[model samples]
Target chain A: MSTTDTKRIVIEPVTRVEGHGKVTILLDEQKQVTEARFHIVEFRGFERFVQGRPFWEVPVIIQRLCGICPVSHHLCAAKAMDIIVGADKLTPTAEKMRRLMHYGQTLQSHALHFFHLVSPDLLLGFDADPKIRNVIGVIEKFPDLAVQGVMMRKYGQEVIKATSGKKIHGTGAIPGGINKNLSIEERDALLADIDQQMEWARGALKVARDYTVENLDKIASFGSFDSNHLSIVRQDGCLDLYDGNLRAIDAEGNSIFDQVAPKDYLNVIAEEVRNWSYMKFPFIKEIGPENGWYRVGPLARINTCDFIDTPEAEAARKEFMAVTDGKPNNITMAYHWARMIETLHSAEKIQELLNDPDLQGEDLLVTGERRDEAVAIVEAPRGTLFHHYKVNDQDQIVMANLIVSTTSNNEPMNRAVRKVAQDHIAGAAEITEGLLNRVEVAIRAYDPCLSCATHALGQMPLIVELYDADGGLIDKKVKG
Target chain B: MSETITFTIDGVKVQGAGGQTILQAAQDAGVYIPRLCAKEELSPFGSCRVCTVLVDGRPQTACTYPIAEDMIVESDSEQVAAIRRDIIDMLFVEGNHYCMFCETSGDCELQALAYRFGITAPKFPYMFPKREIDMSHPEIFIDRDRCILCARCVRASRDLDEKAVFQFVGRGPDKRIAVNAESRLVDTNIDVTDEAISICPVGALIRKKGSYAVPYGQRKYDHEPIGSDIEKARKAE
Candidate 1:
């Protein structure tokens, strides 16, 4: 056959995802993959949106940033506001209530991403018929696990509703403290299903671990790379999702930075904007942008932390580490297992919190000398989230800056897409459905929230368009 | 004038003082005429017109319209209810009333009235008019987007608080609440404890901080409709 001209493959609005993204693949004259770019089309101007508004309202208003993880934004903003009010030390009731809410968010978000979004590809074959390779397909083939996922998600949401005022965009946390405490009735209701929730959480973890161990070889090289990891850890180096100091480690698990204060985030992390993407690439300031880009979310958090506080999750974490001979697991797909471990830990923490007397205390708020500026960081279900705000003397917000988890993972996601393209699509004679699915599998492992990354509002329908080198449309595929 | 007057609201007998308006008399008789601007603590401004009732086959604002002997007021009749709904709808469209993230959502009288009337959305298109936010005060702020021009704050400030800190400026579509100061609330003498700060039926005039502090199912009007207290009072009697 005569040499075919170079072509570009476009995948617009990747399916089974939370936000809008388009993947472009550049092929050379020999049909070898030359470049792959993941473009974020979602628009985000939330920082400007909150300007001139009262600092007290930031927690509520910022929830509009992303529907999937509004709780994370809510808690993080409240944490920043806590510092502004000079309530650096929250009351026991206030701290416990906020922790319960955060853990609830982690559990629900992780469950939704794993069961509803990524499970179909794992439980069913990646090359399975597109029509049946979805949450619906999971429900059809494995009804028990599907129901467990939905119920577990519902349980987490109920916890949020009980702590916050409502399930969606809750008004639970306020400046200096929280709005309400867990009443006996609410606590009892949650306690009723605690055992079952723990059971299901363990089951989900088992599913992820078994699949990873069985397919270790195939996935060890699937979209995998060695880079730096970042997250927050307890003072003693336990995995602390709700609050802690920042810790970063290289691929070999050496500490790059430890115990950095949230207020000094600008001294370390910096964001660089690229022309091709709406989202900015964040990197370690000292290392420079080129090689400083690091990974966040579940895998990074697990790698950066010293130990899991919960018993069963600690066991699981040890097993996960042993697989890599006590090294940071660099495989992209390991995010699933790390995420499940967090889920189990969240369940354990929720049980501990519900039984604590602090959650029932009446002292819910505290105040002290005021501050004009503050910064807060939390481990959102996806990764590390940063919130910084400067308030005027009148208590109005003068400035706001948010580094969302998905935005921090921008370069890593692009690299993941490129790796998948190289392994599956480079020099292929024909682009089969299985090959396209392989690319999606890599992207899904990170569980990216393009909506949060771009901070824009819209729906996404999957559309894949194939174009020739001359810019002629060769084929189109769509799924909603 | 007689000392007392006998009237019927929705065909139910109600007796009240001769000087009382229809809304006051109805309240005395455990009837609620779903109001926005009429507060017992302040003189009725009658700007919202949400309490419109058909008195003797003619429309009248129940807040300002005095009751007469043997007057038949159709407060809950379909005609009157429809008129009230339309007025509430217009109030919603005239300004940007985003109830979703509004701090005063569950506790807002306007939102409660909307819930009682089942107004999921306004029948009219939103004006989406540009509005100013006054956050200059250390203890208080105002979001004009959620303002309904109810003037509760105006009446409470002038008549109750006696500060005369608030007043209505402009006319018709341009009408808005104006503070005594040249531009911002900080320049005025109004404190966070002033009646005007707490009199707002919507999220317009809010004290700084402590928004959405009330949980769901326990907000002022969450479990019951806005006027259910009055109805309950009647039933108790």
Candidate 2:
């Protein structure tokens, strides 16, 4: 085929995920993958702008990282401050409420991704007429499923709202502990709703399982990459979202590192620069420190965890284990399974929290002297999120750095896109929109929030360039 | 350099600190001015417009007006009451305020002011904006429909909290408050503190996700002035 005969694939202004992004795939003469790029187009410099602010204010300030995972940032920042202040000195009730809210966030966020974002594609079929492929479409096509999804999200949100005071940016979880207390009546109401929501979530999980089995060919043919997984694990060796140690494990279930401090995340995980996109490549510091690539998010979490706590989630985990020879390494399909398992676990965890009698007390926050530096780590709905800050004696922040989960999986996302492009495209026929959508969908499976990942905007051209085997630029495209 | 400005409020002439707002002067003169968004901790947003008073010959929001010597201010003129009623009407229409089933029914500033002004029925049609209840965090709760768009919460985030977590998205009637960085409050980053929660005058902002801890009939506002509640909040802080 002539150089001009090469097919170009473009997915413009990708939807369902946070912020804006585009994916482009270029096919060569042999119809093989020439180059694939995941372009992050928006920038808001949160780290730089946060400098010189008070350290006590970091929890509230960093909550601006992502709307969906503000709790992750707030808790992470608060915990980091607590660590700097000495953790044992912090209030126990505040700690409990923080964990409760953290779990609440995980439940609501994962429910959103499973039902509203990804389910539309799986339930309705990705190419099942774009006109009817949305949340509204989900509602019209499967009203029962839609209502369940809404209720599940509402229930999760209600828990957050009840505990923190507001659902979105709850000021409940502060630096010391929580600032608000739950009443017995509020607890009873939350308890009343949990059983129904859990049943709904279980039904949704079954739907996902059936859909995955039905569309094995389509799902398998999408992007897949093998990489080490990293996530937070509890002392009991169970999957944990809040107040746990970091663990890095290989595909064979071998621990690369465990109980790693968040401050030393730089020693275990390192970021690399990529010229094609704003997202940075995160690599394992021990093995591939220079370019030792690793993956985070739903796939990484499911792959690394030894066992889930909830019975329903554990059963889902067993089902997952049976699929990939005891270790589910197929990253593309992990999105579906992670969401189902997490939803089940979130329901179970929320039920347990609502039953706790101490949640009714009013001693939510405890004020103390401000710390000069702090670091916090929590598993956001996407994956592990890290927030580190340095503050002055006046409690104002001097420097800050955030390692967003999406940015951590950048290298793996690139590899997965390339793999999918190679398997599907043959000899450069016009690259169809359906194939491109699949590639973008694979990235969205991680529920990547580009706004939180980049958090800084600069005048960088959105360019897609194709390189020949000899490193010569064959074709270059740009979108402003 | 201590200058005092005399202004006629209702039928009495009162002297106040120079350059103070009519609301502030009237407040000092023991005249009641109903306001939802105005707070001592924040700069005046003037969005609620509930404190509109007849100043000289024009109806003006007392919160925004600067005091002038010999200026005649009517604290409860018919025009002021009408404007306040209209503002309350707009708030009721924009939000999904089901007063009968609300937790803040008796304690709500909007409801109390409405009752005071004899607004038994909303003259405007209810907008019934499709709002979401965010119970994602353990302590804070947000009802987007109940939000009056006074932006006191937004100002609190910017001024007192300094988080800038709450932001007004879209413009005019389409305006809605967003937490942290997203359109949906459930996903956005916002700290659920008492200061942020109490900043909201309408039922839009409330504490936690569950039913009210203090039962409807037993709420503090039923027996005390709303100002006393502010005093309690200040002491607690």
Candidate 3:
């Protein structure tokens, strides 16, 4: 449909969000911005496909949900399967090694977003030349910073490869525990890069500090809105991304919920299904969908947490808190800043877990009688990830429901896109590439890991006819 | 004479011993012909039919079709390529080949062929057929859903392993790979270290603890295409 007839602006295949998605802006009859939506159009039926599969195989199977965060899915599935496997508790070796692997994932993914995806928009002005507004331009201009980014990512990937197996779709996490333990050789290799990793992390924190200081006005107002925040935190309210009780805070940083068990997620959170997009809108159960939408990931973790345990990350958190005047930091651009701080925390945590002697222990796995149901949660780089499974007595999976990290931010991401569209394109007669980029910039700030809640359907019903050797009609497949 | 015969495969002259199949001669001459059930050590059963090539304008399996003098073969032509692609597509739909979560993914011949042919979404409908898995053997588990019905496991067992612990049962869609034992994997005579365990071309027969040992980047087909070795054979010339 042409804009002349419908007043619709569609940005098909949104860029830089880990996977394929699109943003659609609707204008009223008077040419005023009415609404905007970001849709994840690629549908994955992992839930349906995993049914009938044995619970022991779930970890490796579910890892295919997203190539960017396969480890996240791997860990979450394994933890849930841990319960299914009837483990009293994960052994010290298993728990610590999994933590190391998760931290490696967080560090690598966050570095990829900052250095590869978001830095171009920040280093270059948002309204800068569209042609030069990419990582290539960022490298062309800031060579040292670009190299540092690459090195930092390399450091994280090295940890992943060492702990798990490979950079993508490693099989470190298993049902009762991991299939293998971190070898002393691999541990020493990571320790060798510790100093370089810290230096790069500090440099990244400085870049974040400089960007925010330089662009205060833009950071404060662009896509800024009040909403609730969600994350997992320790009992003392320290930022604990790997394993902790669930916690949430209101827009004013008041505790909305705390110490919620991972198994009890259903009691506090609910999902709103929409036809336009397959990604479910997750919200606070008590508040209802109209006002319950909350944000997750780095900003939420930093803003809602009482403190970060690591010395350098704790210091960075304090500085960030002062910048936001404490509690509920809603400036979407500051997500980049919070991300850098979390990266530092991940690096420091990786060092701590690596230094622990238990990581090198020979106990790689444990087992017991299998249970029929299990639930597991972890803080993926995107946000809080939940994996729940129900299996029969035979250990065959009967049902599976996964609330991926990105699905939690679905409502807020869409709202940010709308806010950006309304703010930039409302008064303009024609929408330009710069304006479209603004909407993308707002969504990219969340760093959504897409494709978990995406599906496609063919429009205009068509019949596909298959022919045999003699050109005879053999079969017909139809879709609409 | 060195007791060798020469034939043209895809317009290239290839040499092999007498009674050698076209696939064998072509392979020695560095021509790659895709085959599923034609293992080097086993008898060529001509199963799966993925290695079909035109023998002077008539379609025949390159694995069983012996190379003869003055014969013209069209293996890589558009018509033959489409037929090969369709065969793979049908295999995808007929069985539950979920490569996304499969352990044998990077090393799977079917999956590698799909990647070589760029089979993003299959042309056929996903049957999601009701298939049974026999996890009876403690050392080896058989997932029938991912099986392509190739009897590499059967031959590897009977001839190489000499156990005769596996066989094919039924016909057409009802056809399946079966183990010697009736009840469970633990009842089988096969151990985790059997040659049959490593010989299966698919994820149907997998060693319990042998998966995920090789990382993604270091896997067999991670860096190069499956048939690239044959190409390398050609390139080394």
Candidate 4:
């Protein structure tokens, strides 16, 4: 075999991520990584399946998009339905409660990502022994941090369960407003945990900062690239997750467009397909289709936002800035920083929402007359998710088009994986599992939920085909 | 115009529209017939057998039995009640239904119908099969032990929601609702909104993350059926 053929590497079924994915890299005869391919092997047609259901059923139906972050789908779908149905008619209390429930979801999800999923890769070495490098490992090695993470996550789950009726796909959040009401006792219980959660979140941030700062070499070793970042920014320009206009900023930290409406996301962002994978790449409109690569999720959120709203979160953001010079564009390290910053923000935001008096006895749901069409947008843990629906006269859903955040960044993730794989290969003899794992983890930094993004099909086995330097099929493996 | 078919139900001389099923005529006349698996939102699946009524000296599920001209329908007879009780008993015995500790106990349709028929105990020995509880989903829980295999959730998923998140796995009495391809609910594509949880008539299917708020007797259904609430929503719409 030629030197280039020896350099070609393939990694299948990237672990600890939400869904199934693979990475392949091609190198030249000199062993220089030439091309990287990140392949999504599954399809989940959420938007297509939602067509012809009742508009009111959209939230309930779309909530099934992801088991881990059902609230994101629930809120996004509800907000989209609100837009079609007219959001102004909903009571202020209902809106606030919805925001609270959504924040609760964000808290748990971010915690899960940081502590349970990616923390092991960061705290322990990415190449740490697989058996001792998971959430369970965290529990045995760093018992205090693990307990804090689990408890903090539990607190968030409790809040979501209390408001939504179920922890996963709570029926409490509906089209017009929420379906369940919150009581003073529940509010008080959440408040009781707020201080503890904030404390634990602070500790988690400290741990992240210490680890990142100590391992700056390792953190920076992960390939960093120039890509535009996108997220939902509040009207006042503060970071907002539940409801806000979408914002796209270039790699130079310049805003591409401000206040792009949810329904018009397709206009601002376009999806590109590659036959190699099911995931479609999305890019900014102004960047000229092929050149406009944008990133979302934790790194994107941090880059796009000016400052964190809460005090502790702002401190964590400062520490995050210390590592990446204010805007970290490295896709691999973004997972670590994003988890840290989001954990802080989630805790801080939950405290703020819980302190609101209206949350006690406020009207949870607003009964409104159905409209012909509606749209909702929310910042899921991954990125900005959009839900649009058209209802017939009988209020049944006529059509639905959901553009999940993970789907929007699918192309960029693939590109990032390829870039990292090529850089890490650097004329090496072959792709090492460490290099391929980092590439996959780079995608996981965005916390890509393939189930939510693909939106089509069920647990079909993943077929991964390996190619030699000349694109010849070398080997194949099937993963369920 | 087609010729009209007249029918007598429960001693009421009811004028039926042509081609209307006996159950449809009875429903049109505001007469109520107990049905377990009949959801307005889904196609009629006569799996529950609770809607059985005597038609022309034979017991048949009203949902599947179409209206016949001069059909003598006995919706509530001693024999019909006995058969309904037997079916309910079989369902109760086939699954592990410990209603006392169940979240949906008081408001459960199966339990309510059983109580109405004065069925205090199962005639057959309880098939105490071990079942798994899937808490993989952060939001919902699935108690396979409490499932009676009604297939309502499965049908609603495939026919109405079109997500097909739920499917029947295994065969015979060993059959159960499987979320996605795995036994674990979290790993599956089944979202919390799929309504499979709400559609479950027993405690077998449950919302995982939120169970404590109502404090036992104060559930949303304590005062009314979900059907009535849906009716109000429909009327408003």
Candidate 5:
């Protein structure tokens, strides 16, 4: 087979994911897979965008980077500014309020990703007729599940509105502390539906768990590879999405580095910029770029942590780990199961926070000796997010370096794309809609937010193009 | 005391002193002409043409044009509304007015006027010109990007505060409010409690510590329109 006459397949703006991304797969003369690349097409330079802005405005202004995960950016930027303002220790009320907001963000984001983006592929079958493999198809086929997903997402959004003051681009989390406390009326309203939300979350978790268990043989090696897992975990080794120390584990569940302070993240991790992609490749410093690339988000978070804090999610985590005999579940599709476990955990955490009396406390802000530089990280819905800022004497942001979650998972996503391309599309006589969808299914497993990586807007159309080795287009497929 | 002058605004009779402008007479009659640069406590400055109304079949600023006995004024006509809406649109595209994150959003006069006129977005393309912020002052900061060049602060500082802390330093399009000092506001003698600091109709001048202190629905213009307080008096009369 002559590698010179390779056939190329390009999927521009992968659909159902946030932001714009394109996938290019190269095939040899025999149509065997040669290379696959996931390219983040748009770049808005959000890090440079924040420079010269006042440090206090970073939290609110940073939300423009991603519409889907605004709360994550809002809270992450606020945490960094909290240090700049010398609020080393937030009051209990402030801490809990921020946690509640973070959990709400996680629940809603994961719910939207699973029920809307992933279910179409799983329920309709990847090779199902392209016409019915859409939102209308999912609704027409699974009405009850569709309603549950919508209502669950709505409940999480309500929690966000109550804590952050609005559903979108909320200014709830501020430097030092929050601007307002949860009023009694707001608390009562959320409390009314907390139990129902918890029940729905459990039902969602079961859907993911049963699906993963039933199709274990089929999805076990579907775009799956052994890789390092990274996330933040409590000092006691419990899963903590809002606040924790950095941790990383190898494929065999051995701790590579445990309890690394977020402020000292630079020592252990570094990002590599490549000429081909707008997103950066983050990897462990010692292992270097080639092999150090690790997976993040739900699968990694579940793998790296000893146990989840919440009861039901912890039990679910145990069963999830048992699938791989207590080793890191490297099956790419297992991300869905891991994500649902977190969704259930977030719901339970929201319930617990709603019952606490400290939410009504008046002591919100706490300030002390201010620092000129600060670094903060929080587990966003996708993965670990890093926000670093340096302010001058006038409090204007002189420097900003943000490594969004999507950027951290860049290499892993590309690997997943390559694996899928090799398995399904490499030797095919002709590229079918179902085979192309298999590639999308692999990338969607990570739920990569290309918008956050490139700091672009939401909603992108899918365009698949096939070109000959001479760089001429041979076939095309388009979808929204 | 000046002699009383009578006028008809939008087919309604109104009275004012001889030296009073159409805006003054309209206010006395409980009609809001929607002037941004014209504050009750400060001298009227006709920089913002948002109050343009036809006086005797000619367009004139209600804030600057003096009222005369039996003079006819049309403020509610579609032509006048279009002019006001155009000025609002121009003000928006000419500056980097990000109301979503701005502190004085709900309470801002510019925002309220836009809301009242049903202008969700400007018609013209955004300039997005580079702008600078001055946070040298310990208590107050100036985000010049949001400035509409209304000059309310200039008049307030000169007339009410008696400090002359702010003034227009540049020409049209390049125009901006500058402090009394050579470059920075830190050198000026403006206090946090100065009437000029609180008189800004937009987020151009903001207090440092309290951005979004008030929650939604409780801010100054949240419950009603910006001029509803002045308009409510008309219904009572």
Candidate 6:
């Protein structure tokens, strides 16, 4: 085996992201850890493909990037399209509808990451039997909790479907505003589920809190690294997932940058291309990649925000912030904990939006003349996603640049993987699969969207429709 | 020549124009004929074969087969419906139709037809055949993987827009749509305002710079199924 001569370990296609990962762990001549690398191999070339297309279709087209959080891409592209359409401020109905839909979007994505992707490691132990180390396994272990998770995700999807027409890719988000109002029937249906989901969310918070407290030592040491954190917050420093001011907190939890607009992204954030991977390395221009690389998504949001606006999430945030001891929390495993707090916030936000009468208000859209250039940002379930466009006077898109959340987290994910590898793989007593599991746990902690990372020639998942005798849909089967 | 004709479809007496096809007669008589390429404005080009029906004991494309006297058409039978389902399934396998992430998903004719016939999964293995995507056209881009070789774009460009910019190249599995003007789409004198852009039944030929103008919930096909308007019109008649 090549394990002896070079002592380099190659774990191909890390499971549960399900595919498209190659972790290369290099060992020194003495078999001590030299360096570990996370290699992303998917490439869709979205930037190149969208070149000559009309900027108006980018929201719908680019939203096809990920099925899990298509709404994020849809909304972000819609915001950019809004700027292109010359909408300085959105209509009341449009703003509320987008906010409601985005909450559902974040809720469903976080539910998926926690229950389906990250739970097996938390509940069944990281080195648990590979057969039952999945969402299916969660069902076998804690049946009721798994059901709750499914219901929570269903709750999110149902809200999305009712408002957006479809959960995966609906035309709910248009430039300047949305295309439809949240009908009374749809709003009522979502409102009815709010109380039940709130209970489930509180349950999730308890579960996450218990686990984090119980395993603080192991969780802190396992994929832990001290670095900066970046997320968008409101002007008052409250958490704002949809629209906010950019905030960056250093290792000591001190503010390095604050309240920057999406247009000025070029000044602060820049990409460093590496030959080894298709994903770009994003960093703060002031510090450079060596120290500029910061974490995003749940942990970043939780660390940087002054307080969560919601009552329930605020309580959770207060408890979560205690772990930082006035500094940015870098315990990578705490991402799961931070995720549930945001989920609780989403559930509360969903209920709040449903109660508003303007959710069903009229004049959902507004149109205008074309703007030459625009950039839009939204905090996706993972992290901040950027969609920038340069359109011609004729309204044709000349060029497009996308900085998806997974790409932003590429450096940190690799660093976490490297940390786990250096610790577990060094002086290995024959390098068992259990040690390898530790490295995988690090990557999973970030809940990285590999499909969006490498953008591997964007695969179109195949689905066949089945209809009843009355020409009504009976079933649909999807295959990739 | 007779001014009108009568046809029996699924034991219902249907009335239509004398020279019209069975699909047209069925549609005129308030029956929905599942089709991908056959549009009202365009001349019937039976390329997709999705509108296949049992003409007596044999299968025929309803879009091309003219309605004759006492035509015993089995358009709604489980057997004929299965044939239509098979055709849709073939189309699904033959192209890179990823409806899950397609821009034209809900409003796409292929998808709407699939929904009408109740196709859950294609019987054939997905041939993820590599295809080219031309983003050269400033106003529009075509994803060849989603093209079903319906030739609607070709005909629409030539007949409607009167600019024969798109043409088909190759044959069999290798057959695909291509640009007639060399040096890519930008070199062609195609305009974004051309009516041909709306003629595409799939996500293949999409207008650039004008995406997601309509949100998902308020899209053309949301709430109502694809052919519901025709069915509703027939009911009103």
Cα shift from native, residue A191, model 4 (Å): 1.8
Model 2 off-target regions past 4 Å? A1-8, A289-291, A362-371, A456-480, B1-30, B33-72, B75-237
lDDT score for residue A433 of model 3: 63
Instruction: State the lDDT of candidate 5 residue by residue for A1-480, as single tens digits.
Output: 323567899998788888788999999888999999999988767788778777888898898787777899999999998999899999989899999988888999999999998999888988888788877799999998888889888887888888887888888888998877899998999999888888888988998999899999999999999999999999999999988999999999888899999889999999998999878899999799899999999999999999887899999999999999999999999999999999999999999999999999998888888789999999999999999899998888889888888888899899999999988998886768888888889999999998888888655777889888888878788876
Candidate 4 global TM-score = 0.69
Error of 2 at A391 (Å): 1.1
Candidate lDDT values, in order:
0.89, 0.72, 0.82, 0.72, 0.89, 0.82
Model 1 CAPRI rating:
medium
TM-score for candidate 3 (chain B): 0.95
> Each prediction's DockQ?
0.75, 0.04, 0.20, 0.04, 0.59, 0.29
Candidate 4 docking class: incorrect
Q: Would candidate 2 be rated incorrect, acceptable, medium or high by CAPRI criteria?
A: incorrect
Task: Please write out the lDDT profile of model 6 over residues A3-78, one tens digit for every residue.
Answer: 2334456666666663377676776656677778888877757788677555666777787767788898889988
Candidate 6: where are CA atoms >4 Å away? A1-6, A127-137, A456-480, B1-111, B117-237
Put down candidate 4 lDDT per residue, A32-146, tens digits, no spaces: 7677776677876767755543455567667776788888887777777666555556676677778788778887887887888877877777788766877888888888878
Which pairs clash in the backbone of model 1? none
> Residue by residue across A1-480, what tens digits does model 3's lDDT show?
122423556676677667777777766656567878888877768898788776777888788767777788889898898887687588899888888988988888888999989988888878888667888888999998888888877888888787777777777887777766788899999999988888888888889878987889876888888989999888888898887888999989988899898889999999999999878999999899999999999999998899999999999999999876876788888899999999999999998988899998977677787688888888899888989999975556899998887899999898898888788977665656678778889999999877654422322232333232234443444422
TM-score of each: 0.97, 0.70, 0.76, 0.69, 0.97, 0.80
Candidate 2, residues B146-186, lDDT tens digits: the string is 88888898888888877777887788778888777654445
lDDT at A256, model 3: 86
Residue pairs of candidate 5 with colliding backbone atoms: none
Provide the lDDT at B123 for model 2: 97
- Classify candidate 5 by CAPRI docking class: medium
lDDT, candidate 6, at A242: 91
Worst 10 residues of 3 chain A by lDDT: A455-464
Shift of residue B27 alpha carbon in model 5, Å: 1.6
lDDT of 1 at A250: 91
Tell me which of candidates 5 and 6 scores higher on TM-score: 5
